[model samples]
Target chain A: MSGTSAPATAHGPHHAGPYNPAKGRLGMWLFICTEVLLFGGLFLLYAVYRYRYAEAFHAASGLLDRLFGTANTIVLITSSLTVVLAIFEFERGKPTRARNYLLFTLLCGLAFLVIKSFEWGAKFEHGLYPNAPHLMSMGFGEILYFGLYFTMTGLHAIHVIVGMSVLFVAWRRIGKGTLMRTRPAFLENGGLFWHLVDVIWIFLFPLFYLIS
Target chain B: MAETAAHAGAYGEGPYFNPETVKPGPAGWLTTTNHKRIGVMYLSLIATFFSVAVILGLLMRIELMYPGQQIMSAKVFNAMFTLHGVIQIFLVVIPGIPTIFGNFSLPTLIGANDMAFPKLNLFTFYLFVAGAALAIGSCFTGGGAPDTGWTFYVPFSLKTAVNVPLATFAVFVLGMSSILTGVNIVSTVHTLRAPGMDFGKMPLSVWGLYSTAWVQILATPIIGITMLLIVVERIFGIGVFDPTKGGDPLLYQHLFWIYSHPAVYIMILPAMGIMSDLFPVFSRKNIFGYKMIAFSSLAIASVGSLVWGHHMYVNGQSDTAGIIFSLLTFLVAVPSAIKVVNWLATMYKGSIRVEAPFLYALSFVWLFTIGGLTGMFLGGLSTDVPLHDTYFVVGHFHYIIFGGTGFGIFAALYYWFPKLTGRMYEKRFAIVAWLTTFVGFNVFYFPYFVMGWQGMPRRYFDFPAKFTELQVVSSIGSYIMVIGIAMIIGNLLRGAKKGEKAPDNPWQGATLDWSLPSPAPLENWDVPPTVTRGPYEFNHSEDDK
Candidate 1:
């Protein structure tokens, strides 16, 4: 790392190109580290409530549809693969193929969101969301479980949308040929982020749906 | 870019202020990627917020003068202290040493031209400004400033009519700035060191920031999420921590302390690093137990995180958890004690300079020791039962934060002044200011330790008539301390533009920074330097000077 990185400083200030794509990996990984902890915080909250109200959490988990959870999991995981393939193709000098792969990633993102909203809507129609009339009508443990359920999933959905937006931009820029091998950090980082969003859903799927 | 015509040195090398800026004045400042200018920008912002907090503190002191509605109503007093805490913690201290000195010197110390992410560095500064503006704006916007205290303990924070969502959101913004800065600095150190400068040979100040950057990266996110939750609870009516909705209020505390405890190390570790650098220069000797002092920084950062439960001891953490936390808390003291001992050992049997920075360093050793010893009292569950929220806790806090980190900052300013400006402040005024601040500080805060032990609770707008004498003394001391601070700041500001040119190699330091121009070159060096030995090898630098 030192051998490779120190040369930028050695180049002196005027010509020292500090924005090499490799350094972007360090920055993006650090950012991804923070994102994991951001969700890690909610995970902690879930763990605490899960410990305190194991039976109630199990009961509440039954309310969420395993079929929708399974479908969204497949869509999100497939989206991550497409993002990686997009980057893979871009690195291989196949911009056209990369754009196609990124387009698929965005489509998968949309499908996952559509599936997630349907799942949420089914619960909402039954008044099972946080502070809902029916959820409040249930036991305190159930209220706690569904409260965490919506918060975690709601937060995850927001990340999915953000990831799709990033990839969408990358797809357009790739089509425009603005990205180059020397500085493809933008798409590379976007792919890492898309993977994280998918990975978080992977955790969310089993934690909520499989618990039942 | 050529607007300044203020080349840095005799050879007319780099631009004096900013290298990439296209405009002269404020526009140049706003777009600058120069770490020195960014450091100055942070200084300017911190000075503004510190004054506001100090004034709020003095007003609180005035209200406590005779204890019975001396100046303000109880409700107003609550708002004042809350504002003070919010401004001081998020605005002034959390971004304290590392933002100011680390930005200014870290690149130069490691012989890099600038931070690895210079544009991102400027972005963080602007982000900090926006966050600070949001925090300041919250004082007037919704229901007036929040009165739920800085901790913003849940249920109350949820229930408060005062504007908490805006304050929490402001904190969230500030946390984003802190996290990005951590990313930038960590990358700067990892990738931008001089040719031969490995981790071991790097200055303790860099190590201090390196350790602190990790803490900032790891711990700050937790606070960011927690603060976001506060905003979420208020805006979305989430019952995540509302006890009436089956949520536990204790969870709020657990989450708050998780980040906040590590934050104390964030505040002090850099200040400790400044001392590690200062002791070697003043004493003209190799730093004693250099590796121990360096590793202690990392040790302190690690152990500091585990002890957050200690803050919750009286708040009803289980006895087992409290015991575990208490033991971990004591473990932190070991590394801290190692640092203090090593500092004194470095000064032993050497030719000591006793300059302004060294004087402050000496003061830091004793005052911080007092703060640390008193912390031992509060860390124990048995003794803490009495002192948890009393004036004693308040006194102990002021000693550690104000006496310790605050003095550490003053010492650094004095030490770095010549290097930053190519000039020197009046030594006589510096001495006088330190004396007044020291005497006034002791007189001001010492009474709180005594009054608190006698059972005077903190944050009270009124107190018993029997405690009148101590309160009067404290208020008087606050006045003196404020005057002293003004003098110290006045002297430095005066020195920057008008003081005599800095003597060639004033401190005779061995680090790479000391080898550079007094107000160092804009890019620090045309070619990055090569390191050959440890940071404190003063044996060789004497002849070079």
Candidate 2:
């Protein structure tokens, strides 16, 4: 088996040139699986504490502003749609349209983070910050509830920032005409990540805000 | 041999010896994306950590040579044992086989050029280094070294002012590295196989690494989040684990063991795969039950995850939970037994080679059986309650981890030395090392079983006068084992530079790796090979039998 063709590089031509859409999708999906497990651990904690302190968890959930939570949920779901549209535009060979859609997706991500920070700030104003002096006066379950809330949402917000940055990079590449329809794996992977961030928010919104 | 040479030189100036093709110079090695280079780098890093950890262990054993402290204070002893456990578990054993042999051999064994994500492979290597540096650096930073053991169990972990945050964060970084490597390997195994190399047709070692990658991906995240929670608790006084904050300490045990129990399989499975590959080759036979061995790896991964509760039996978990976990722990042993039986059966009527590698593999069977059978004793509710924190538990753990996986690693190192360096290690030195190590390993750990059974607790700086004899025996054994380990490392180092050149197929094995040059080229195959038979097809060749 010698000298039949040029040697394949480490990333392999399957990924590097004329993207094998499937490999990119598979890698991203595998990454998404790890992300699920990451959040799954937090969910496990939530489930355990909620079971033990159902009343306190319910009371804590009621204290969270459902309107802001619902609004942020809508913002994230809308971003997921925009990112999907970005992929759709790229697939349709409209580079300019895809770039605009990506920009919109990034804006939606920013809006969600801004709203989330405001929500956290409101909780801090009400003395519900994790381990704050006021939380020590709250029941053990409530302390745990707020603890899980800040940790989980805080981690989710980090993902939103990361997802936004990935989209921003893709947006820049698209503008350079380098990430056109033919080379859309970068954009597709970015979309997949953004959608993952949105999906996690869907769960977080219900568990922390609407469960009660 | 001549025919082998023809195929070996078919790819000119092999990657192992050719500086240009393999990226010459220290800088090239630092930045290279070649999986083999990265694998060598991992082996070097692991070796360094293993040596340091082993020295710490020797010191600990010396401290326990008599009853009272021999060389260090109780505080120093505590930190020494803690750092030793942390380094050995996280840096050395857990990442040992997969990163070293898996990165080097998986592609070649499957007839591919390199891992699916080579740059990511290099990235994981650096992450491991950074994590290790952070862990080592914590010793020099605030409040002295972390005295909390590697498990970092509840209230103690939370209360310790010693740099628990830095140590825990180091583990978090290391866990992320493991997860990324897992993703890369799973993707590689799924997509990078040579044409006609179906899952069944892949070598058992690849199967081992593939199963292990899943464990790493699924189980590691729990630890990641757990460690983060600990960090949060430390910084914010969250009472998730601290009893003062209305947190249940048991929750920490539950979450820690969830990842760590399966982490045991993560440490052993790839090594198990190595034995699967070795047994057939040395026995000069096709593997007796290929499907059995292959499926057992996956079986162990799945079943092992559920047995995490076994570790919490004495922690006052519910009776039903304890019974269920004990049963699951027993269930995991079935798959392990299936693998051992298959290995022995593979050797049943074959012309077995008694080489250094095979000796280690054989020692693995004997030692692992001892390790596994003793594990059953601990899996039982009645037996574990009494032996839980005793020297018996420590003995059983060392037997399985060090004797089982550690020996498996030694076997792999010797077996692949020729392929890795294009030179044969001195066989006599290898055998002597194996003998001393085997004898020393048993001497070092076996008495712990007796002492433990006789009511000696573990992790203590001093023992009563009654426990002194066995402790001295174990300590002396450790010194012998250290010498043996040094010989093995020295032999390999010397072999790389001065030993005889190895042929492509030194052992006459029938795997794809043996089809290439002794040191495989940068991109493994000149043209990717299309598989025509399974990894072990010895029955078709008279010489192989």
Candidate 3:
């Protein structure tokens, strides 16, 4: 995986010749284009519905816990920081340090999700979730408002899980010494995916919890 | 990672790379990372599903033969068409040309031995199978078949009693597969091209795929998220696109067209690439306006992605937006028109080979031109008002997708029959099949333009008595077309198994593929290949730099 191609195993024929990190990097970026557009669709919805029901969206924003929203945002941003640091350690030949950084980043991802669940649970207890009696009473605008809130944030949560899974794989590969300084694509691409997850939340934070 | 010692020793030195010789049976093929074997795998699946979709089309046409239900009830008709649209679009055309031809020929086209990510390529094939299974499963698992069209328009999609969630999830899975394939192709082209073969020297098909990969990566995800949201809406009644809860169905139209329109390009651009390769080889001439044709592919991908709004003109989108979309839609025709002109110019005065592949390519140009020209009428804001959702729309797309892309697939099969299987098909049967298909295709789709101009709506199982005669004619035409399709499939399949051995450079093609030995090896080139000249330097007849 360094300069040479990975061997063909019982897995059948493999791409011969030397391994190229740029190829992996480019492939990951193209994948990020899809993830961005996937989230872009949701953001377009937020823009449309927000334009339609400005007053109701603003009032619904007031109901959400800014403390918890701000806390989760900080947790995600810190996780992005750790991912950056993980790659930095990979660059410095300190695989153990990089591994620890990745573990921390993953833990931050979990913490972000745990805090997200509490926020969602609190809303659920207030009968604020979609199709609940009180949310139905909240009328069309608020129901739609909460519906998008859960949809976008819930999707963001799923992405958080995926990013963690990517980091986990990177962590395992790095410890196996296949994804080190000479072959850092696995770790580097994992960092790229994590950054995407973090950036999507930055937009989601302002749109739902902040702009609201 | 230091496997050069063992890899170089074992690479390309053993088996002939044909299935007959290269580790045979399901064990070797099912887990293959070799691009060639993966291509054959895709071909088998595509052929099977194509037959299923063709049958659905025939049945629907038969049902619409008379005024009232001829063979199926209105409900069954709805389900059939829905499945027909879903299967043909996702399982066939969208992935059709790219995965099969791209997998089989791209590395050779670019002079690389394997894709940049081989394991990813095999994983992508499995992803396709998984998505396809779930999509077909949606038809019979819970409730009844999915009645909402492939678009899965909102409100109805959410409220439908059928298994909408499972169906939409299948599309999500499919979209993921498409996105990964796109990513792999882009990376392969960027990093794996033979040394010295820059973008300018690369085959135009590589250009088409490079552009298509970008479209697949960027546009497919909108539909992926949209489909996922459909499932979300179904399970939670989120009312995101449900009108009763203040959600706008128009938003659904916007989101759907955002991907579906570009998807049409995903279906055709590669076919156009095939046309690019075909015109030169058959003419034995340098491809005219090579740079223009190459840039136009990029032009098509970029300009084509923005024209999705053209589909939403009558769906309550603002007139300013509609007019803007209409203008952009018109712009897309320019690049398409340029490519067509260049192809004709490529064949203008050359010594032309009147072969079956050439016949299919000729039909593609003629039919695709009509499809594009008719698209202009529908692109105009005023003209679209009448044609929207009419049989006109249906006919226009069928011309592009089936006539254009489908024929391109046939041409590729005929043209590469020798390279792929080391055999030449019975040429007479191929031409007969092509003639039958050409005649049958026009007969089947052309009447829809007339009926649609006369104001016949689409997706309706029963038509008025006034429309009965043309409907019957269309049904008969489809029967002829299906026979031709079957013959085309049968001839090539029979040839692959038992035809005469084909000579290298069977078409005397000037491309790198012709330089490859018959039944091109499992990993493509025996050693690393480096291309020096332009792809269509037929006079030189060599890509060796």
Candidate 4:
């Protein structure tokens, strides 16, 4: 894909006119704000339910594997650093290095997802999945807690996968020289999105895994 | 080349000036990224949905005509009303003015060739179509259409065997579409304004869209997540909103209204902006308090988000919460009132032209005033309890949304018909349609206010004998409204086909849109326009017809 010398504009007809980096960045920020609100609603629900059933929520939080959660949090924070470095390298005219950092970010994303799958697998083995017979028999607050746990983390993991795919695309584009420093909005937006995913995880980790 | 010449001959302009050739043919329409084509597509899509929803609404009224399962079973009646609410709110009013006129005119009004992100604009359109399809498709699947009403309040939404998940998912998609459009519009306003077109110099309509875009971006995600939660609860039996699972239904209401309340501004702000532009145009005067009108739109969007709790007045929330929400609701009204006053003051002593568009705008003022004032009744703690679920609440909202935004659309369509179609509608028929619709609308909805005040609960299949007379009256009024709406649609279609060709500047306006040829060219302007005057500068010598 990178070998094609299609003059970059062949990326699509939508890229008409001079690219406005500021507009692209502003649009990304606005989108990030929206993602915050999206997760904010779920957080509001957690807060309300946690307040209502404090003891059960603590017990439910205890059921989560903090080691896995902590490891995933560190992995996400490392990924955030890699994405930032990727942007730094791209802007500093080091496309190969930026691509390598993006690759590392993508790896971290995979690692996070693999760890998440293992954790979820263990929960499923315990029959703690939402509305499972075992979960249905649990205390109401515990049921609600696990319900929110899966939903929130599941949504975050989807974001991680999406962010990884975006980084992969940016990496490929940078290799093709289509996403050079002159046309860096695509890479910048990808980095911003990855950071948002990390920031959301930062919130989710303490709320869901470490609250107890 | 042949197609180009054919359009040139038809439109009296060559390929160099035609906007339609950005793409050509049926395939072109589906794939076209031109804002004009997308806008026209939205008009058609919205009209189709509006027609279906209107017909469904008429069916509901027909059943209420005689009461007690007159034409359909109670279950069918529930489905009809639910679909009606969903369709009208999501597919019609919410997207009404902004997607239609805003898409068509915003870039031109600001002297941009197209939206900042034209591709994203087209994507938003497709999202709308996909959402509408899913919403309508739900009717044929999984125990038929959802009967849980548009709100889809918990406990019931969770228990319904109907396709609540599909419907809610449709809403989620639609919300995404609304947010993306909002982002596109806001970005356009910020980055695409013509040289010298400062924010203050922008048309009030632009300001209206700007404010609405903020609401759409900020408020829509809450509802998007809320709807997803509902889908989650339905599919996974998560107790996020289910009472059996330690969920509080009130949380759903809170989350729903948090977005839904500000969504009211999303529906009406652009319409209000249209009025701001129209009053100055028809009155042949500069808008009174232009800054106030512009600022009020922003104020409305800001304050509107905080008052969602007003919708929960009867939901057993704390009185302190209700009082706070009620006060904030009343506070939101202040900005709305300021706009009304400014519009009226603009028309106070000017040379007013009573055109069809102007007539619709005038009716919007009257109807919206009634709507707004009645809203005060619903906003106050003392009065809302009696009117909470009554027909009064229904009447108030229809007056605001249907009467306000709906007529705002009619006004914009008539005002821009010549510009949009490059043809003049029959003036007399246009006025006739307006008068009939105006009269019929008041007659139809006013009775609901009376009946609601007299204690007729909404969404009921049957009522007592004492309520029979007013129900029949309201039904008759709806029939008249149907005829009037039919006439309006017929006039526009016929006008586009055979009406007289419109001149470039029919209204002698000063906005950048008026500077363009009717059926504005593909790039909107061959050369980017520079603005040296305000959007409502009526005193300019060239505009002094």
Pairs clashing within candidate 1: none
Give the TM-score of candidate 2 (chain A): 0.90
TM for every model, in the order presented, reads 0.96, 0.96, 0.95, 0.95
For candidate 4 chain B, the 10 contiguous residues with the lowest summed lDDT are B1-10
lDDT of 3 at B413: 89
lDDT at B389 for candidate 3? 92
Instruction: Give per-residue lDDT, candidate 2, residue B449.
Output: 93
Each candidate's interface RMSD: 2.7, 7.0, 6.1, 9.1
DockQ of each: 0.53, 0.36, 0.44, 0.34
Candidate 4: DockQ? 0.34
| Clashing residue pairs, backbone N/CA/C < 3 A, model 2 | none
- Can you write out model 2's per-residue Cα lDDT over B430-545, one digit (the tens) per residue? 99999999999999999999999998988899989988888899999999999999989999999999999988678887778887777766666544566667888876532353
TM-score of 4: 0.95
- Candidate 3 Cα misplacement greater than 4 A, ranges: A1-14, B1-24, B542-545
Where does model 3 sit among the CAPRI classes?
Answer: acceptable
Which model scores highest in DockQ?
1
Please say which candidate is ahead in TM-score: 2 or 4: 2
lDDT of 3 by residue, B404-523 (tens): 999999998898888788888999999999999899999999999999999999999878899888888888888899999999999998998899988867777766666666767665
Clashing pairs in 4: B19-B522
